[model samples]
Target chain A: MRAIFLREFFGYFRTPVAWVFLSVFLIASVGVPWFLGNFFESNDASLRIFFRFIPWIYLFLIPAVGMRLWSEEKKSGTLELLLTYPVSLGQAVLAKFLAGWLFIGLALLLTAGMPLTVAYLGDPDWGTVASGYLGAFLVAGAFLGICSACSSLTANSVISFVLGLMCCLLLVLLGWNVFGDLLLSLNFPVPLVDFLASFGVLPRFNPMVDGIVAFADLVYFVSISIFALCFNRVVLHR
Target chain B: MSAPHSTARIEANGLSKSFGEIQAVRNVSFSVNPGEVVGFIGPNGAGKSTTLRMLTGFLRPSEGSASIAGIDVLKHPIQARLRFGYLPETGPLYGEMTVVEFLRFVAGARRIRSVELDGDLIRVRKVCHLEKVWHQTIETLSKGYRQRVGLAQAIIHDPDCLILDEPTDGLDPNQKQEVRDLVNEMAAEKAILLSTHILEELEAVCSRVILLHQGEILLDESLEAMRKRHPLFGSVKIRVAPADADRSLSVFGKLEPFVERIDRQGDHFLLRSRDKRNVSDAVLAVSKDAGLALLEVAPVIPRLEEVFQELTRPQSKFIEEQG
Candidate 1:
């Protein structure tokens, strides 16, 4: 398991994919908040604009990082050699997932300069900023887990990327006002409608972004990540 | 049943696999003893790769079982994998990695840590002739060198059994010879199961040959036994003048005691006999008695290509007939 983790961790930087992902993510992560939102109306009291765009940014960036995790191995015929190693399928999948998650974590850390710049410019809400970082990290882990499962379903990287994007888009759309309206018009049971809405990414992640670490939200994200990783292992074993 | 000190490296019994409607392998059973080089020869799409995949635990069999050193491969694949080194048909390699880096990764995967890595790398490089290309990226190396790197990684762990599928698929004549020599050297301590389309390779290195056809073992015998059991053995060709051909040919049929069969084509008489020595002597004596000039007399040994064609042709006919 350690061997697999080390190999996958180094494999990310050995190719140009890691550099490309980091550069594009950093550009959008910082550039959009400062220029498009005008530094949150020049107030700098909170990272509201940055936190608002994170789910959107992650929709594309996480797939870029995780799509090739298993697909490339399958296409190159290395999956067979990997299976022949003395490692369980679950161990291999978990190792690869952790490696990709760590890579995105590193890319996210590069944007620490944005928070530092805000701190230098004005009295920003440090508590909110810390929680927002935590929220983004947890969301990135969730996105990676979902993308890892998609990656294992196909040998084509493009197909896996598209499937991953669609899966994430579905999760993001579930909690939107439009979806809630649609469910209400159908006259669905209130309890069922509320239960479904609670599963959405926004509802579960909103508290964390607002500087509140709820136990239920933490359990929800961790459980989804573990479920996705277990599904990835099952697909690979098949 | 487990033996603490048994010597068999691989054992399979009634192993079979099917991908949906297509049955790739069926009712196949074979075992490789220690230090034995068993050559697997078959036509294309004859389940050679599928069988190897099952033995290496890459694919689960639909029936029967495959065991490596007494550990059931399907029940406990990791243990089976630890006991064998496998080289897939495509020669899986990380093109972005240098030869040394790839070897290091494989060693790591096999759980060889920093302590024994240097010695393992030295032995693998020496055996695979990879020292020259150690620093070269895999993508930059030629096909033969890439194959060498693949082989180097396989043996880095010094597994007791090696399963190689078409190990010499794309190599020049010199490279092929070098690989053949390498396999021969490795076979001294490792039980090697090598599959190839080239018949000469089997003849040169393998002590025993397994001829597969239509997912079945058509023939499994030592090289010498294969030659002896071959139906075309003891066949000879003789060219004689037409003047004495009639008389010489007339006596050929009477020499059936030493001949298994005979075919006459104008002035050339093809003779297949059970007793090669007696047939040659009788032909000499008859030609001398009739004063017939014997132009050519030589034994006709059937090539492996012919044997393969004969084995596969019957199966094709069967399929066509069933259709």
Candidate 2:
């Protein structure tokens, strides 16, 4: 497992993928809030705009990062060698996922300049910033899980990327209040609509973004990541 | 050959694998012992790769078992995997890493670490002739270097058994000979199972063969015994004068039991035999006794190609029909 992690983690930097990905991620992560969100007009010390664009940015970039997780191995015929290694299947799955997650964590870490700038300029709530970072991290993990599972389904990285994008887009769409209201207006029961809405990314993450670190949201994101990794195992086991 | 060696280092017992309704391998059982190089030959889609995958613990057998060094692969895959080195059909290597980095990763994965890892790195680099391309990334190297890197990783742990699928598939003749020599060098200490399309290479290296056809083990025997099964095994050819052919035939009619059948070639009459024996002397004396002048007399050398074609004819026919 450790070997797999080391290979995958260092693997990202071996090619230009890591540098390009981090560059695009950093620019979009910080630039999106400064231009689109009311970053300067709000006149507030909080980084609400930055937290708002986290899921949208993650929905695209995480797929790009995770698409090659299994697809390259499968297409290049290295999957055979990987599965036959002395490591257990579960360990292999987790190691690969953690590798991608940590690399993304490093990307997220590079954006610390944004929060630090806000803290240095104005009286900012550190607790809320910490909670928002946690929320975004978990959201990245959940998005990574879906992409990893999609990656295992096919040997073509493009197919995996598109599938990952579609699945994550569906989850993001369901999180919107208008979509939930549309479902309720279509004669769906309140509990059933709430149940479906709870699976959305924002429903699980938005509370944490608001500095409300709920236990259930944390468990939900972790479970979603676990479920995705298990799905990765299933596709490979076949 | 050589009494089939001693302890079985690689064993497959009643192994079967199926995907949905199609059965890929069925009840395939064989063993490769220490000090034996077993050649696995089969046509494409004959379940050769599937069988190797099962033995390496990459694919699970549907109903039976495979063991490496006496450890059941399914029950304890890690332990079983540690006892053998498997080079998959494509010889996949991590293209992003340099040769040294990839070797270190494989060594680490094989549980060889620190000081031990350094020794293995030096050993495999030397054994596989990978010292020149040591610092080059796998993707930047040529096909031959990539293959050598693939082989270097397989042997890094110095396992007792080697399972290689078409290890010499794409190399030039010289590279193929290098790999063959390496396998031969390793045969004294390890049980080596390799599959190949080149029959002459098999004859040069393998002591025994396991011929699979239609997902079943058709023939499993020593190379000599399998070669003997070829129809042209002991056949001989005699070139006689065109006018003296019929007279030679009359002279040869007395040796019917020794020569099972004789057919006319362009310039020679091919004498078929039931067993491989010294019948050239008999033919010479018979023709000399009748005063029939002979132009030439030669015996056929049995080849694995003929035996392979004879065994895998049905599949060959299908391929031709498709074309």
Who wins the lDDT comparison? 2
Clash list (residue pairs), candidate 2: none
Model 1 agreement with the true structure over A9-88: per-residue lDDT tens digits: 88888889988888999999888877887875768567877777788889998998889989999999999888998888
Q: How close is candidate 1 to the true structure, as a TM-score?
A: 0.92
The superposed Cα distance between candidate 1 and the true structure at residue A196, in angstroms, equals 1.9
Candidate 2 chain B, run of 10 with poorest lDDT: B314-323
**Which sections of candidate 1 miss by over 4 Å?**
A182-190, B1-8, B240-247, B250-254, B265-267, B275-295, B315-323
Candidate 1 residue-wise lDDT, B140-196, digit = tens: 999999988888878888888889999998999998898899889888877789999
Error of 2 at B136 (Å): 1.4
Name the lDDT of candidate 2: 0.88
Q: Give the TM-score of each candidate.
A: 0.92, 0.93
Question: What lDDT is reached at residue A5 by model 2?
Answer: 98
List candidate 2 stretches off by more than 4 Å: B1-8, B240-247, B264-267, B284-295, B315-323
